[model samples]
Target: MRRSRLGRFGSRLQSRSWPRFVPRFVPRFLRCLWPDTLFGRLVMILAIGMFAGQVLTSTIWFDTHESRTLEVPARLFASRLADTARLIALAPDDAARRALAQQLGDPKYQIAWIAAKAPGVDATSTAGFRREPIVQRVIGDLIRGVLARRLGAPPEIRLLEANVHDDSGKRGGILNLFDSPMPTGDFHVQLKLHGTGWSGWLDVRANEGQADALTEPHSLALDYLVRIYLIRFTAVCVLAFIAVRFAVQPLRQLAKAAEALGRNIHRPPLPVTGPSEVRSAAQSFNAMQQQLADSIAQRTRFLTAVSHDLRSPLTRLRLRAEMLPDPVWRERLRGDLDEMEAMVTSTLDAVQGIEITETRHEIDLDSMLEGLAQDLREAGHAVSIAGRAGRPVPGYPRNLKRCLQNLLDNAVRYGERADVQITDTGRSVRIVISDRGPGIADAALRERVFEPYVRLASKEGTGLGLTISRSIAAAHGGTLTLENRAERGLDAVLSLPRED
Candidate 1:
């Protein structure tokens, strides 16, 4: 029987060593940072998105907090400044007005008299109000509004300098990223005041002045920031892990089931549970497995029926041929009947070897190969054995023995001598059987040689030995390949995986 051309092509593609696909522009380090599993990628995306949202919301809250914390202090300061402006209007001279203004201020709220010259540069002159942080902008607007309301008219307020600082003396213009703690805010201002017919800029330095309130909230705010970040991050990560694992576990189980199905036709079907899509996939896989099993059984039954039916007719033909008078005709009939019997037996063996039903066990390859070589040696075949397996392999011993026998027989019959080498490669077991025959010169024929009944020469046997051998190798989850040797003959390499 000839195998399907498409199947042969698929096997060839699988056997050939093609270069793996990789992105040409991506660096190796970046590729390594990328997560390969679904759970990892999903968690990373969720964590990053949550963190970004937290950063945005924290900034808005920080601005609102700055406005509220400074509102009452700003109103009181404006009221005091309004009272001083009226008092200065009552002073008898410029000297007295300056003196009164200087004497009326406190440490936290200082007022001084200054004559306008070039109207000296302020911090905002270079720092630019457009570039003010959200916290600074909010507080500044609130102070200006309160001053205007108290003075009965809008005052020209110039911010000379401003800064916010924490108890640790770390100065910033706003709450740091994600509401880092800050205790106090100080500002220097040059306010334009009009009294009667004279107007001048009053220099003022002031700060938000709740000593106990500011100090107490510093620790509480720090604790709150830390707790919010830590708790939310932990919760998000834990929740993401649980959700992603639950979603991906079904996929992992499905993959393992598919892999195991290739090695065992009788493996149990997948449990149909999970989401609708997952359940549908499991059902489909179970159906495919059943179809494959039923098809194989039908093939086996059909072959058995044909073999049993052909035997009686063949025996009858053989008897009728024996009754013929001519010796040449009698011998011809006998040879034809023998060939027919061999073909049927070889075909059945080929199919049976493809799927072995024996339970796997540890087999000592060293002793098995030595015993096989010894038997062939006693039978007058020039077979040589070398090397060691070193460890036992997990496989069906009888089927394994049959595979080796076919390889050895092919070598001894074609090449006149067979040299077998067994080596344990740590990861796998390699058995190389080299024959001293005219090695197949046509590279194309070497692969097709494994196809059913494919023959390189007119040997006096059914041409199914290599086919049966390769089937046995595949059943054991191993590979059997043929290659031309360097000097002469051919090498048949059988590689069996050592790990699951």
Candidate 2:
């Protein structure tokens, strides 16, 4: 039981701390490699997949083609050399030997003769083909095995020169073989005939051009590289970006709609367009918005009706209080009725404030604040205005005025004075109303005051002022917050987003 408890505790700890822990633990370089946006990450993923596929394809194809390229030429060259040696051994006379060499000779291979004492080099001669140790060794091994079987003895082989020419007087089937159909740099090999005091030379040339990338050095490597790395890879990235952009467009629209709905739940329904999944999401979001608007409307109607019905009863109570015989009793009952009426009126106002029916328009916030300050000053309240918004802000002017007026009233009533300042950023606007009076003692109660009927103990008037102000601010996609001043009093800040 204890072990299980420990496990559960560990799981909860990890779950709670995972978001904070991951960034510190993961390598910074790896984190930097990833892009922040969804589109960039999607493109990166697709590019990686394409690169991997290309590498795999190149590896497999090169392996298969390279084997055939190397071994096929080596095997064919060895077999033809063996056949030449065998025919020379079977010749009955010198004349017949010469004819055999000529008849057996072909475009890729040339038959020839070399004197035993000819002023020429052999396989031990260190030049060209001999300089390439691996190539020489492999060639020697392949030809020797075939020649030894045909000649019934280990044949003496010599790689005279990689590119031999016919400056010598000796002439034969392979003499002046430059005129023959072999490649220019054909390699020469001399095989010793034991019984005969002569040596036979074979000019072996590779029949095919270097075609495989693995076995042969590629001349077009740069071209292939440019085509694959620059052209093909770039094309793939561009296609992926375009495809992902289209895919994410609907998501962007959904997010924008959601933001607008937060400011005003009565926003028009979203269009059911785009792909099937996106259309479905849009339809569902539209339905949710409609449902929320309808619910708020229903509640507002109920509150309005209740307030109206209660007003009639309150009026009758006022009349009955006026008819009371004792003056003190009548005064007390009237006070009670007045309080009841004020509470009902405040509640209804709060409800109606949320159901804004005003059309939006551009209003000069600076002018509005100036007018408010002037009005308060004329009404014998200590109010001053400072700062200016250089531009107009988009909102319902009446609602915004009401929101500011409420805050100003609170500041004047409790704090004894009001200081209003308007700050306008192109994207948003902020109005700060400050006062020098005893702020709420309890920090927790600052937010609670925005709830219906909630008020500070010393403050008089309906508690719905802050609530109604906040509802108006929210309706305009704004916020209202209260903060205690460092020295004394409170600061009520109203922030609203500006129209694009």
Best by TM-score: 2
lDDT of 1 at 357: 62
Model 2: residues >4 Å from true position, as ranges?
Answer: 1-41, 60-226
Each prediction's TM-score versus the true structure: 0.64, 0.66
Model 1's alpha-carbon lDDT is: 0.75
Tell me, by lDDT, which candidate is best.
Answer: 1
lDDT of each: 0.75, 0.71
Lowest-lDDT window of 10 residues in candidate 1? Answer: 121-130
**Cand. 1 TM to true fold:** 0.64
lDDT value for candidate 2? Answer: 0.71
